[model samples]
Target: MIKNIIFDFGDIFINLDKIKFANELQKLGISQNDNTFTPILNEYEMGLISTEDFINYFKEKLQVSSHEIKKAWNCILLDFPIERLKFIKKLAKQNKHRLFLLSNTNDLHISWIQNNWGMDLYNEFKTCFEKFYLSHEIHLRKPNNNIYQFVLTENNLQANETLFIDDTEENTSAAAMLGIHTWNLIPKKEDVVDLFTKNHI
Candidate 1:
């Protein structure tokens, strides 16, 4: 039986505009082509590279200043609604199973988030999780066999007893391979707040 829920933060909680980001990057001379940039992003997400290195790579490729690159790169992190925060808190109050947040995020993004939301709000937000695992902090990222193993072994969680929800199929499939139940949510059609109702919690 599933006893723990691992939630991914991006599309699952906050909305992202792929088209907006692409258009913004185009203004900054970055390619919208998946062939060129997606693999670089994938490598960074897999914990294969450092934040500074990733930023530097973009800055050089796009021939833009760090500030310009930073703005364009961080365009995905838009808003955090009180309703979403309330929903997570409500889920936590159930006290039925351990709740965790696992995201493949890096230092620069984290620093930007801290600055954007400020420390107090971030702490309040983080309090909703039994454990908050950010890739840069843990030095382990998603879609990797070792990172998934780290979460289970370190937390003493049974793989079959955990359910991971992520927007990325790659990450979910990797966890599913380890016997963890997964929901690769399609945000365009699905409402995360309705998971409990639809999944019949």
Candidate 2:
């Protein structure tokens, strides 16, 4: 019996254009062959670097304005469907599972979300979860075993009874290795609102 649920924020909740970042970067002359930004990106996602420093790094490397860098960075984010919010709200009201949100996100992305989604809507989405964990805030990102262990230990949740849903296979697989149940949801094709009907949870 799944007594607790862990959800990923991106793709699972808000729709993302997965290729948007790469395309935007390509336009700015950064390509897959250019790995200069990869480490810094990982650092930013892990909260190891400040947002200002992050923007500065890009500014110096790309010789672009901060606004342009931010724009390209946030291009991956698209929209959050109302139905998904409704579904989570319904689940929250049920008081059934101990719900949690674990997302690999950074300060810039979150700032964009807050400004775009507005505080009211963001707060509404936030309150639905018992504990909302962000990578940057927690200094822990997904696909890392320690992060999974941290969530389980901190919440005092049994791995066997916790179901983690994410869009990334690596994240889901890592969680599965720790004996947690997982669902690597396919974006567009798999709507989280159909959790019960589709996954039979």
The candidate scoring highest on lDDT is 2
- Residue-level lDDT of model 1, residues 1-201, one tens digit each, is 789989998888877777778887889876777577877776776667887898889877877888887887788787777777888888888888899999988666777778988999888889999899988777677888898898889899999899999999999999999999999999878867877878724
Q: Rate the local accuracy (lDDT) of all candidates.
A: 0.83, 0.93
Worst 10 residues of 1 by lDDT: 192-201
Report residue 90 deviation for candidate 2 (angstroms). 0.4
Model 2 C-alpha lDDT per residue in residues 1-201, reported as the tens digit of each score: 999999999999999997888899787766757787778988999999999999898888878998888888899999999999999999999999999999999998999899999999999999999999999999988899999999999999999999999999999999999999999999978889999998648
Clashing pairs in 1: none
* TM-scores for all predictions: 0.86, 0.97
lDDT of 2 at 164: 96
Model 1 global lDDT (CA atoms, 0 to 1):
0.83
Which stretches of candidate 1 lie above 4 Å from their native place?
Answer: 26-29, 32-53
